[model samples]
Target: MCYVMSYIRMAMCVILFLTLFTGMCVADSKGNLALNGMAVQSSLGHPQGDAQNAVDGNRDSDYKKESCTFTKTEFNPWWRVDLGNVYTVSNVTITNRGDCCKERLRGAQIRIGNKLDNNGNNNELAATILTAPNGTQTFSFESVNGRYVNIFLPGNDEILTLCEVEVFAEKKLLINI
Candidate 1:
């Protein structure tokens, strides 16, 4: 037979490309990183690709010099997102940024990780994906988990923008390399 049917069709195309590209490579934290934990400091914020430089909110006006440029105002460029580690965040997605969607963006807030856990208490600002009528605001934080994810960009003088920010992890995915 044609060389055993071309080696069984190249081993069934390498087992269907290893179960459809490794079928969501499973292990744990999507890409593994439990070497003892504690050691994640991702600059943890906006200012990328230029969403009006991400934020310089509440500038001057007697606030005693804090935010310099990029403080147009409709709400205040809010993107304080800082979910460095301590996973368990269901979902989060924000898009269309840089030149900002012509300002006037009102309502967008999130605050996680009040700390305290370990039998202390506190830690409970769960879910508030801006209720509704806030279209354009992408969010799917299923169970309302937390870990420091603040993104309050509401009508900050009409200056809002985002370009793909998806952070989701409920389970599945270890190393799909």
Candidate 2:
């Protein structure tokens, strides 16, 4: 009788452990959410510097390659991407213009949120570019839930240029055990 009781308790314990573990396990997949997102900027510096180029999955830094975005020289020039749905953003990777003026991206602010106020530039500040990048830089941070990401440069005669902007996030699937 003692042996049978011990075996039954062990079996119950194993079953309980498996059920709790299964419930806690979340299937998550991380991907670039900005790849197919809609992008826009304050103003165009050139016809070839369309905002869509930043999300074209190309990191070509050379403007001549026609894979970068340029904003006309203005105060607080900003660029933004509309992520189709709200996500817990993990990080933001930015490729600077390598052909010529890489310093144009310095002092830029990255904001993320669902609010459309100020063209979404007034959202939560995620990161700031402290110095000019030679090629590319990735800014990782605590997860922020938002549907829009904006890059804003605050100053007069400032030009915002981005070769590529990649937003990474993980989508989690909850499983009920």
Candidate 3:
């Protein structure tokens, strides 16, 4: 009986370990190609309102209460994300602040390419948002292949507040070892 009980306990421990570590083992199993929670940056950012907030998987627009980036009002403020590798981007979804000032996202240009010149301004233009609505907005365009995705707001004095930015592309399957 003692040997049987010990075997049962060992089996239980293995099960628990697998339950906790399975998520880590297959973390990239998402069927879609959206590079969520990846390396991101911006020209201007605050301590609390860091650039990663836009990709932190949170859509809460209130920067004070939630995770979001606030750039100093300046000419051509921009935010960008490196997709790690070049991908055939299908579309990009941006979430605007629902609390206030959703109009600040207007006239923003979404550019995608491998070029880093002039803060990715030289990249091919994917889409230009004329009037961005509140909440999440998905901008679809022809598949553009690039390693970097940039969102630029051109103006003399304007702020760019992005709650969330989701980039979707053609999904790539990974083989788990």
**Superposed model 3: Cα runs more than 4 Å off:** 1-42, 172-177
lDDT of 2 at 133: 87
lDDT of 3 by residue, 21-96 (tens): 6522212323224335454444555677677778777778787866677788788888888776666787898988
Error of 1 at 87 (Å): 8.8
For each candidate, how many residue pairs have backbone atoms clashing (under 3 Å)? 21, 0, 0
Candidate 1 at residue 156, lDDT? Answer: 24
User: After TM-score superposition, what is the CA distance of residue 75 in candidate 2 from its true location, in Å?
Assistant: 0.8
C-alpha lDDT of candidate 3 relative to the true structure = 0.76
User: What digit string (tens of lDDT, one per residue) describes model 1 on residues 18-128?
Assistant: 768764233455532221222111122333323222232221221113221222344334443334455566655443232324233335454445353321123444444
The RMSD of every model to the true structure, in order and in angstroms, is 15.1, 7.1, 9.6
- Candidate 2 CA-lDDT value: 0.88
Candidate 2 wrong stretches, greater than 4 Å: 1-29, 173-177
- Assess the local accuracy of residue 163 in candidate 1 as a C-alpha lDDT between 0 and 100: 33
lDDT of 2 by residue, 1-177 (tens): 999999999999887887687543344646788996899999999999999999999999999999999988999999999987677787999999998999899999989988999999999999999998889899998877778999999999999999999998767623344
CA error at residue 62 for candidate 2, angstroms? 0.5
TM-score of 2: 0.80
Superposition TM-score, candidate 3 onto the true structure: 0.74
Candidate 2 clash pair list: none
Candidate 1 overall lDDT versus native: 0.40
